[model samples]
Target: MSGNRYGHSSPPMFLVDSGGGHPGEHQYYHQQVLGQGNPPLVPCWTFPPARAKMKKRGTMNNGMTWVLIMILLLVFAALGLGAYQILRLQNQVERLTQEMPAEVESITAQKQVGLPAELIKMKQIRADFIGAHLIGHADQRSSSGTLNWETQLGTAFINGIQYHNGGFQINETGYYFVYSRVEFLIYTCSHKDSHTHRVSVLRRGENRTIMEDHQEGFCKSSNNQKWMTGSHLSSLQRFQESDWLFVNVSHPLFLSKNFQNNFFGLFKI
Candidate 1:
């Protein structure tokens, strides 16, 4: 039947059934008449292949979206962790500072320093005398004689602008160890008419010359005597604003006998 289409010797209808040959319009058209008398329509299947492709594409897009979301979440989480770490480090530093107990003793070192109260009193007496604190103390130089006399809180009227410790004061006055180191001794007598320089000590009423007048230059020596300065050495003593320093000199430099207005004044202790 497949080779000869026009031959009279053809196969039976039941013989062609195996290959679905009805010889009419189509094999399904006979079922429409024999059974329910309706066109047996085959449902169109367009969604299967396309649905699989769409599913694969949707899966890929969802995977990429998930990856991007994960990356963003990780970045935010990392930033939050870094901020937490910074706060933790700051807390650790604060704890370390608070836990160190030995620093309390180290900060208040004045109680452990030198000079017992006795020695401080003797030095305070010396500060009351010729150690007049002057501010902007000018010596034919740039600055005038200015001193605070309250502490090493300011510069010294001494050498170049280096060490600025004038001296401290004695708050309580009692029996005190006087630490006197005779730095230098200049010996000379006043002119019979006018004035000359010399090293001597004068009591309140009695005038007495301790060292003899040497007509040469000033002599230098190391005599740790409680006798006071042979000459006026600056001892800028610091004092309070309302306190008054009682000036008493062993060798009176500013007085009626050896009087000079520029010797010592204008200080509150």
Candidate 2:
């Protein structure tokens, strides 16, 4: 121990040798003062090196970053695919829209091309029908056993048929259904009185009866009252072009004056 000028004892110095035998190894020293208790040395703890732990943390951080990057990339890829699909659909729609007018025009052109043929077919159908309906005329009387008709009176018409010389001339050759009706008025009842209606066709200056109807016994002789009767003749006949049809009745004078009661009509079948 050594005393300073202030009379305080100085600490004693002690040298400590390192265990290494290498030359010029470093030495450590500690000092302790007399009459002072030495402090207890605390045990030092050594931890593992930080480099490996830092490397593990860095590796974990890199893995997490890579995983996030991959997720982001997948999301972007999905978005890109969706955008491409939308664009493709838009293009298809635009293309179809551009072509629609041409398709419509083509359809219209086809219809236009077929229009004339359809119209011609319809005209032919209309021309194929041959029919005529002629009503009786009150002013015109029967001549040579043939009854005359009104050409332009009520409900009287001729289509594909001609009227000449008190007969209807067929303009087209086909089977025809000919019909005639005649109503008669008798002032006095007589059993012997009879009625006859006949429809005939004349072809090439030759006449042939096609339909005939007879009526009798419709009146009482004892009563001597006014009576009425009717006769209808109808038949299906084949006619050639230029053939003429005529209607004849037994009693022209006694025929009813009503146009509806006396009519001659024929229609091609």
Candidate 3:
């Protein structure tokens, strides 16, 4: 309908019909309504930029919080497992301690009942096992002097015992069976009387002899070659620690170089 505005002919504008118009038409209707002293309508719309950024930040914070919670849960789970393992080990240790005395008693009873015969025999053999067997120096020529012994295979000592300087040094103090054999031979058969041979067990700086033996060689009045052998053995005799024992012969030059025939040995009994 035609309307009069300020005494001029003009079309009437209604804000209620502005919804059917374009943006420019709607703006014109708003201006006209404002000019008519009508209170302008203030539109309410959601501002996207600020709300979008806030929403994105909130989502990021939630994700980080969830991740932190998960990490804490994992850490706590590992700590719980460690504590449980420690407690289990402690329980096992206590159980073992509670049963230890009974097990020890059973072992004691078995020991008191006595060991097997084989074990006893083995122990006796071990106790009687310590000894040294030394042979005369094979490389040296037979001479009338004190015999010097070898230390390697041709001469050997065991059980912490050793031979040095023509003597056996005792390492352990015990009853030992000592023995020696010396073989004597001479190319010249000038001696008509029984060829005398003597072997003695002597210690360092001892006036008395521990053991000795004397033997006469088997020689015919017609035959010229002479040979004699003497052997000495001492029963289980008490010996002191670090005692130096050696074989002494009256005729050292006549002693044979043969190890099998001339050897010294001792065994603990």
Candidate 4:
């Protein structure tokens, strides 16, 4: 230790040897006094060269910086991909919304255009028409057994036309085609005699004589039973509202209960 003039001890100086015995080895290390007074020299620590340590630190720092930059690039790429997906979804939703109103309007227009034809087709299916059948046996010869045939079949008339007392009363005025059929049968054939069957139509009020038909049959068997049929059809005849109409047969006793053999029908034209 060396004392200065101001009476403070001076710190020792470190000395590293520049001359060496080997190629890479240090020769010696010493402490040199810098003041005018000669002092005892002290040995000091010799630091190793700084190039290798600095190079190692620089390499570590460069590796960490590249890692940080790669992480930032990955984060940015993820964000961009997410944004692209969101934009695609938004565009799809917008396209569907734009087409929805056009589809709805097209369907509505089709329904509106077809409405009148559909109504007309439905009206044609339900119209004013009627049909009936005489449903029991009757006696033509006996006056007591001959009664008005009024019992009707299932759903006899439609559109206000009704069956009452063997007559059809009309509710609407229109031209109508009328038709009727009757079956006549007899158990005993007495001789070879000609028989006459008649069916006629009459309207109640002004036009009573509308139409009539006749059927003739000759007894072919000497003692066997005989059968005949009579049918009457009228052309399109004009009728009025509340008009009553019926069928009349000369021999009602021969009428069988078979509805297929005895029927009456009318249809408005």
Model 1: per-residue Cα lDDT over 1-269, one tens digit each: 22245755433232133354554654454444333233335444446898899999999999999999999999999999999999999999999877864312122212312222222333355544222222212121212211212222232122111123222233333321111111122243322212232222223334343222222222233344222122332222333322222222222221221111112222222
Clashes of each: 16, 0, 6, 3
lDDT of 2 by residue, 1-269 (tens): 55789998665643333343632322222222343333344455555678789889999999999999999999999999999999999999999878773312222211233322333333357766567767777855655668888877766777777898679988888887677777888887677778888998899999998888888888768475778887776666889999989988877878787766677777676
* Candidate 2 lDDT score relative to the true structure: 0.71
lDDT-better candidate, 2 vs 4:
2
TM-score of each: 0.28, 0.51, 0.45, 0.43
Q: Model 4 clash tally?
A: 3
Candidate 3 residue 153 Cα shift, in angstroms, is 2.6
Query: Superposing all C-alpha atoms, what RMSD in Å does each candidate have to the true structure?
Result: 20.4, 23.0, 21.8, 23.9
Error of 3 at 131 (Å): 1.3
TM-score of 2: 0.51
Please list all clashing residue pairs in model 2, or write none if there are none.
none
**For residues 87-161, what per-residue lDDT tens digits would candidate 4 score against the true structure?**
999999999878674312222211333322332343367564333334332323545322255353432333446
Q: What residue runs in model 2 are displaced by over 4 Å at the alpha carbon?
A: 1-127, 222-224
Instruction: Evaluate residue 208 in candidate 2 and report its C-alpha lDDT on the 0 to 100 scale.
Output: 94
Angstrom error at residue 122, model 3: 8.8
Question: Candidate 2 — worst ten consecutive residues by lDDT sum?
Answer: 103-112
Of candidates 4 and 2, the better by TM-score? 2
